[model samples]
Target: MLLQDKVVLITGGSQGIGAGAALGCAEHGAHVAINYHGNSADAEKVVAEVRKKGRRAIAVKGDVADASTATAFVKAAVQEFGKVDVFVSNAGICPFHSFLDMPQETLERTLKVNLHGAYYMTQAAANQMKDQGHGGSIVAISSISALVGGEYQTHYTPTKAGVHSLMQSCAIALGRYGIRCNSVMPGTIATSINKEDLAQPGKREYMEGRIPLGRLGRPDDVAGCVVFLASDLARYVTGASVLVDGGLFVNLQ
Candidate 1:
């Protein structure tokens, strides 16, 4: 197993990509920790799935936007699992609004949960990894929206762009400590986060035709990449941005 015996913590793991990644890591022999904001039932479902794979698993609850909560969640994981070898800051929220009338509160909320939350959550995880002296991996879930800019995401895209920036900066700052940081930028994924919008007439069809690969991405599509970055296979990679966009990036460009 690529991640044999490793301890991995994934934020927002109750469902969607986070849940998929938790299962992926567990299948590869990593003890998994899932942190959910407000869905214990769903989080427990993920925990159950991981345990069925014969891997140790736990579900943590916290609002990643708060630094103290972020810190506490990592500390709690360390308490249960001894140490963290991989941290996936995957919790995110995207609310749509045009720049002309985007509310300040909306922008702030998006930044707090997506950008600021990830910044400190990963920092706390990095500290744990450094203390262990084994080095580790940090995978920030970014979005192609960061690169392409969204029509209704004037306030949202910057936060994702910020995640990419954070990955690059941390890759440099944490390199000496043997810690590596990178990002996985996904495009038009079909998850609860976008379900309502996707269900609208023509939305799904429009995206299907737009994406070069002829479909929206699944949670597992991105999960596979997360496992790679967190595994030893990506030992030499850091500050890298892997796109799980199914060739739409180059097509629509």
Candidate 2:
């Protein structure tokens, strides 16, 4: 009950890490607004699951990458829940390609969705939180690639790095208002984004060997860290990047 009676808005929350965060927040007694760009069915399922747990939940459809949509999504959440206590900027894309062979469109799309989207959503949510007079927490779902560049993920790495930077700046600028911002950098999580990479027979094994934990991370691993950051337990923590990479970044020599 660390987040009891809190209101949380999680972007890209229909599935994967976002979905996990929505569920985790709800389980801790937070009323959650699950935002999904597409896949309304999946979003509904998450809402249902949250309600089944005796918590209020809603599925909000909007593209976080667009400023208008992001603003609308935040507005809807505030309309339903009165005010937002936590905002999780988890919407992102990773269409990997070699640095030399990367397409401009792909790079732009990655930057827009991963970095710009987080910026707008955070602004909208922070504004609402400030008006409420209680302040709030902002969490961004970055990746370990922000710390250690990935070979075939050139475009994605930069966006994540940008997110990390954004979190630091926002934390500093908003601290006066009791608002906290932090980023979570996850490594090799078993999400649909990496389905193709892990589909190969030996690929999953190869990745597991690199991790000190001897296994790929799960969505819940990242979600747990996010929930903690959004809770009063982390009230004194801000402008930090929590690494949930199972030692992958540290072990890389």
Candidate 3:
């Protein structure tokens, strides 16, 4: 149990990669605080599953994109668990549109949730970790799109690139307090968020063809990396961006 007795907070944890991280953390004996913005039922489901594994779990409802709500969510977790050992900033949104025709609001919202949310969440969690007098880990969920810009995903790319940049900067600023910061860049993962598009035969084939691994990634694939980074096993690692992209990012020319 690499994370035995640790406390983890995962934002946007009701589904996709976030939900997967909650479960993985629980499996490793970490008490998980699952935060969901608009999906209380799904969040509850994850909480139930975590409890079934004999670990403490709770569902917290809040919008990570908002500063006040992110602060409150961190407060609630600390109230229940005494302290936060790991904070995973995984809340994000992606709506694709051609760069030349993308709406201003679309771009703003993407930055708000993907980049600003990470900022607020990390700020809130880092404060708590600093007060606890023990070093902690903060993992941000970036995307391979940040490394290799995607067509029609210009807005998302910048936000994710900001995440990677944030990780490096935070690592340096927070190192004095024993806090570590890192980012995980995931490739095409099979999640409900993209099920509609991936269900189409042509789109599915095109996505799979780009991966050298010959298959799309799964949520657990990225979750596994998140858990490792959050564990003591990665105590000496910080300011790093680990790509769980199945070689897709490398294949980009």
Candidate 4:
């Protein structure tokens, strides 16, 4: 019950890592506001699960790529929960493509949704927290790709790195107000984002072999860390990037 009675907001929370974090936060006694891009059905399901935990929950639909969506999202959460205590910038998209032939639109979309989206959402949340005068926590869902690279993730890795950097700088910018900023870098997570890629011949096995843990990561594995960062347990933690990669990073060396 580390987050007991807190108000948490999450972007791209319809499924995968985002959904897992929503449920994890609720389990710790926090009311949740989930923002999803499209898929209302999936978003509502996550909201239902949060309510089943006896915590209040709501599903917000919007594209994080749009700057206005951030302010609207925070406003919606405040209207429902009275205040914001934690914000998780988890909405992102990754379209695997080779660097040499990467389409302009693909690169642009990835940047807008991943980096710009996180920036807008974080700024909006920080403004609300500043106005409230109680400070808060902002956790970006970065990736191990931020530290390394993938042959097909040329356009995606930079966004993750940018997100990780965003948290570090925001930690300094928002520190005077007691707001903490950090990131969780997951490695080889098995989610829809990589379902097709992992299905390629030997792809999944090859990835597992790279990790010392002998397995790929689950959404919950990263969710637990998100919950911890959002909770008072990490009150003194800021400008940090915690790896939820099951030692995959060290194994890479």
- What do the candidate models score in CA lDDT, each in turn? 0.92, 0.92, 0.92, 0.96
* 1-253: candidate 4 lDDT, tens digit per residue: 9899999999999999999999999999999999999789999999999999999999989999999999999999999999999999999999999999999999999999999999999999999999999999999999999999899999999999999999999999999999999999999899999999999999999999998899999999999999999988899999999999879999887
- Model 1 C-alpha lDDT per residue in residues 135-252, reported as the tens digit of each score: 9999999999879978889888889999999999999999999999999999999999999889899999999998889999999999999999999899999999999999888887
**Can you give the TM-score per candidate against the true fold?**
0.98, 0.98, 0.97, 0.99
Candidates 1 and 4, the one with greater TM-score: 4
Candidate 3, residues 1-253, lDDT tens digits: the string is 8899999999999999999999999999999998898778899999999999899988888877788988898989988999999999999888878999899999998899899999999999999999999999999999887888778789999999999999999999999999999999999999886787688869989999999999999889999999999999999999999999899877886
Most TM-score-accurate candidate? 4
Backbone clash pairs for candidate 2 read none
Q: What is the Å distance of residue 146 in model 3 from its true position?
A: 1.0
What shift in Å separates residue 112 of candidate 2 from its native position after superposition?
0.5
Question: What is the model-wide C-alpha lDDT for candidate 2?
Answer: 0.92
Q: Per-residue lDDT tens digits of candidate 2, residues 111-227?
A: 899999999999999988888889899999988989887888989998999999999999999999999999999999999889998999999999999999999999999989999
- Scanning candidate 3 in windows of ten residues, the lowest lDDT window is 192-201
lDDT for model 4, please: 0.96
Which residue ranges in model 2 land beyond 4 Å of their true spot?
A: none
The superposed Cα distance between candidate 3 and the true structure at residue 44, in angstroms, equals 0.4
Clashes of each: 0, 0, 0, 0
